[model samples]
Target: MASVNTLPGMAPTLAGKTAYVAICGLGMAADLADGLEAAGARVAIITDDTSCFASRSGVEAAFAAVAERVGPADLVVHAAASRALCGAQKLTSFGEAGFRCADTALRATLYALQAAHGQMAGRGGAIVVLGPAMSLVGASNLVPLVTATEGQRALVKSGARQWGRCGITVNWLAAVSELFAAELAGMDPGGPELGEACALGRRPQWAMDIAPVLAFLGSDAGRSITGASINMDGGEWMTP
Candidate 1:
């Protein structure tokens, strides 16, 4: 039911490519994996939230094992939700726990990049970070998640700039988190009101609206777009 294989015309031929789906949340990770697989990439999924935040060596080891089990990763799609529901805290109530939530997100992202770079550095590949649309527009009661979202965005740009010479592209795709059911809310909270729809006048469908975009980004056609923060919010939140 995901969007990857349902698209018309020639699908991206990621033949012989090894891709990693690293996610903290479970909403669309399975669908995304199916999408990549439909496009011909050998996919490995890393859903262990604790391994990434625990220590440097652990993440490196975990990632290395995956590459060995499958093959060196040619692409990585990441979404950060490192803890159980790391969002929806009132600003006045924000505390050390809030900071820890933010830290987990940042730490997970950095590890993803570091591990992906270790594998893709000399070989050259793509790294796509999935973010929450609310990060583009501030959301109430989600200050920490927002902070981590933007922080990850900065990392994307930095990785793009530094890794461009190596043929590695880093970009962030801000999706409509509402579509992922309850699984993605920890990363993306405070969605629009019932009446507040996108410019397109509706919420995006995962298979119909969003998955196709990821298919494109993971393909060779999207090589030119790097260090970009694209909001696929059904135009609900337009970037000014």
Candidate 2:
């Protein structure tokens, strides 16, 4: 997919920062990586053997392999998520799949936070966790995925509360389904129109829309922001 241009008012100012992005294989991941790089942040991609989120040791090992490269990372974005989309009946028929999906999404996030926390223990830094916008607006055939994404949001909040004293901030970013090909394919054809569903009245620009948010969260500008869920779906789901 072609990379979208950075949005107006979003410039590259993360010159000496290092960002470690886990493997999610989504267009958003690539876009965020590109945006971070464009902002002058040294970007490191960690994709070696991170698929097995069920194994904590395995996940830790994967992060450990790139430990040196991720030294004191200024930003750690956990975009890796299981894309298993199934109907509610399918969830009941094969409960294991649901468990696996949750395990993959939640554990991978926990592991990433652990690794990033260790690196940013003394110093302050930002960690961004990506979730699907459907998690907030309950789409059909997406219970497992929604559970996992919403659970990760809770994790981000708890981590933010606990790690704030250590000068570490944790936040969640909810992106539209366009970023995830699988989720997009499974979306209901008769669903509400994007413009009608979102207050902004337009589909989101996956890369262009999310890159600046990631950059801001990873920069000092977002230091005071923690335990917050920033919706990147153009006001698709509002939270009071």
Candidate 3:
């Protein structure tokens, strides 16, 4: 669905660098894949909907589709997630069903990350995970999401710590703003002033805004930065 542009003499600078992205939500998967390609990196994608875990076959097909144009290298972004937003009242009143759904997202991401990590360890590459900003604070109406977010942060830290020595750097792309712009399109979206007392009173961010940061973290420039959670949100959410 994405169109490719020819740049006469300007081949991609990051071309031939191969990267596999899994669990891309909505259209962001395709967007990130295309960005990686523009940078000269070969890209392959696998969504959770595929039957075989990370959908290795799907990724292979992507590589084949662009094989003649750009070669492949090494990198993977493991990010499979489902809506785990359960109103706090329900979470506290009911049992585990809601909580389980939320927890599953973290586990799913871990499974995909581990699979990708194996391949990266074999080739020495970078791993990036798409994490949520809700993980940074407690939203009374959204307990399930909060749990999953925090759990993911923990996973990123552990993954980076264990894999850093293997020539693989793992980190979380913590979005300081709402990366889900499409969903908020007709909602008459408001700025941080709406939630000032709760968060740091900052504005939400678009998905495109977060893409560049993710691309940077997955590049060689971010090679030395591992096990760190980089906030892409404005100064809205800060530590005291």
TM-score of each: 0.87, 0.85, 0.73
Tens-digit lDDT track for model 2 on 1-240?
234334563576677888877754343556667777776678877653444544557656666666665555888888656654333334576468877766677777887788778778898899999877767766556667677778889999999999999999999888765455344444554454221376777756645667678888888888999999888877766753
lDDT winner between candidates 2 and 3: 2
Give the alpha carbon lDDT tens digit for every residue of 1-240 in model 3. Answer: 123324222234445577766653333677667666665666766664442333445444443443334433366766545543333344655377656757666666666666666566556677777765556765554456567767887888998889888888888776643554232222123543122343545543322344445556667776898888876556556632
Worst 10 residues of 2 by lDDT: 187-196
Instruction: List runs of model 1 lying over 4 Å from the truth.
Output: 1-4, 49-52, 184-195, 205-208
Ranking by lDDT: 1, 2, 3
Candidate achieving the largest lDDT: 1
Clashes of each: 2, 0, 6
TM-score for candidate 3, please give it.
0.73
Q: For candidate 3, give the lDDT of residue 39.
A: 58
State the TM-score for model 2. Answer: 0.85
Q: Which residue pairs clash within candidate 1?
A: 3-207, 198-236
Across 17-128, the per-residue lDDT of candidate 1 in tens digits comes to 7888887644576777776777777888787743553555776777888987998888888877644647465756766778887888888888888988999888888899
The number of the candidate with the highest TM-score is 1
